[model samples]
Target: MSTTQTQMRREIEEIPTAVDRLLSTSAGAIETAISKIGNDVPFLMSVARGSSDHACAFLKYACELELGLPMASVGPSVASIYGAKLRVPNAVCISVSQSGKSPDIVELTRAITEGGATSVAITNDATSPLANTATATLPICAGPELSVAATKTFVTSLVAGLWLLAEFKQDQELVKAIRALPEHLEKAIACDWTVAANAITGQSVLTLGRGPSFAISNEAALKFKETCQIHAESYSSAEVMHGPVSIVERGFPVIGFAASDAAEDSLIEVADALTEKGALAFVTSKKAKKAICLPHQRTDHWLTDPISTIVSFYTMVEKVSTARNINPDAPRHLNKVTETV
Candidate 1:
């Protein structure tokens, strides 16, 4: 599959299959390209723009939880926009780009390397400008994605991110768990979006969480806005309380990821808080969303929830779009490969 492929049919597929690809590729390179950076870097960081940026957010969260490595995403314009600088002298900069040629990302990679950090490009093109500068590269097998709204590539990137974390940490339990993704993906394809549609179809939706869960909410909101053309946004439960409180109103579909774990109490509190404000909350557990749940994803380690949840919502969006007879293969205002800086 080339980078421009998008399938229109409604079909069920297991997420584990994608995770398996991630684990195999990352682990297979553990002794070589993938893990070699440990020699020069004591920490990890990532940079991207748009969907690729979101992927790096997930990567930062996963690497922190799985490997205890401190990480950050250098905003695309940190150097260009604010003249702010990345100070890591021995860090790994993982740049994610579908085309591997975004000028901003390439510039950022150059900045990181000049600062004495090693960079690994996780992209769809090995020869892209971004890849051309990478010390190493990890290409996703999502084929050619044709839709302007990203789907498979986003989900695949999440898989690859976690798989890479497993490689650096050599967390066999987590690797074994990722191996089950294909099966989970198969089951995820079977998810029904009727309820999600009913709640969000014509309304503005707000997804709220904290830490990694907050990132998941961001991705969920992004998918909703992209595929369904709806108004959706995310808030950290904490941040929302600070100022976003005024926007809370009746009839808003506020999806709260109240998974069981360290953030469970706070997440549930946020759900309660939302319910108190007259919003609806749909919570899924690792076991509740079993097919896509990876290992070591206990309540304390709920960062993995988004990995499964993205696969879940991506399937639902496809379902809802098709039910509305909206061709998910192509949305109204987008194309297969974007050429943004």
Candidate 2:
């Protein structure tokens, strides 16, 4: 095996610094974005595709649980392709894009802003079209990422969006946790997921999560496919028991992402159930009965703990890619920026 570190690994290791940079440099921008939302905002709208969309999903849960506002994702094609007009005068739209250059995202953000919604662009490039189109721009400050599989950018985007929500709600506890994330994420990057890495022996795998962790699960599934050429599927713990369990077989790999939240016990239960069915199940929580517990990093707050899990996941997936003799820095057909319209 080659001892050379891939760009993906370097980017994954830089996640903590990226988040720290975002928190330190983007505070003023985050505050400015919050001011634009105003107090009487009715709801929230999200716009993005791929990993950026997963970040929006994570923010969707945060907005509902923290701000008590409903967040729905508005498809970019509605404006880019169909030329449909949106009327969200009282809503606040958050568009997440690492490059902030996607034509579809830029077009939809423009439409929503023209329709009377206050638009906020969360991106690394403040000069990109999406940032120029939105009412406010909160740059992620993840620096330049050369890897096709995003690591630092994704984590920074999560921090940027969560920080915006935390500041908007003025929740000091969550804000403190956000501020302390750099160190926690440093530990998260060192978490040993060797068991999970060894579990990927076949072409297919299953991942489970609930609540905010489900968004991380979605990102994990995407990474497995893009980086390791594995057919991975993610499901909510509640939904997996219904029909997805039919595919579980003996010695099958199942990874469950459970943060220290209300849904942790329920998610672990599903991991244990899958373990009982003879699958090699691994969960992040220690309360699992039959499932194996992977070493995980937990933050001071439940909301931020799931974000740490994704950092650990990035490390493990990078190793999986190298062990399979694939170059994670460059996936077969992916680019650094996808400007879809």
Ten-residue stretch with the least lDDT total in model 2: 30-39
Best by TM-score: 2
**lDDT values, one for every candidate:** 0.66, 0.93
lDDT of 1 by residue, 1-341 (tens): 23322363322242355456655665544345565575545788888877777888878877887777888777767654555556677688888887886677887787787787878888867678987887777776666655566666777777676767776677777766666666656565555645655666554787776666667778778777766677788888777767776677776677665444476566656666766777655555443221112222231124455666666667666665655556666778866665555
Clashes of 1: 22
User: What local lDDT score does residue 193 receive in model 2, on the 0 to 100 scale?
Assistant: 98
Residue 162 of model 2 has an lDDT of: 91
> Candidate 1: worst 10 consecutive residues by lDDT?
290-299
Off by over 4 Å in 1: 1-16, 39-42, 78-87, 286-303, 322-327
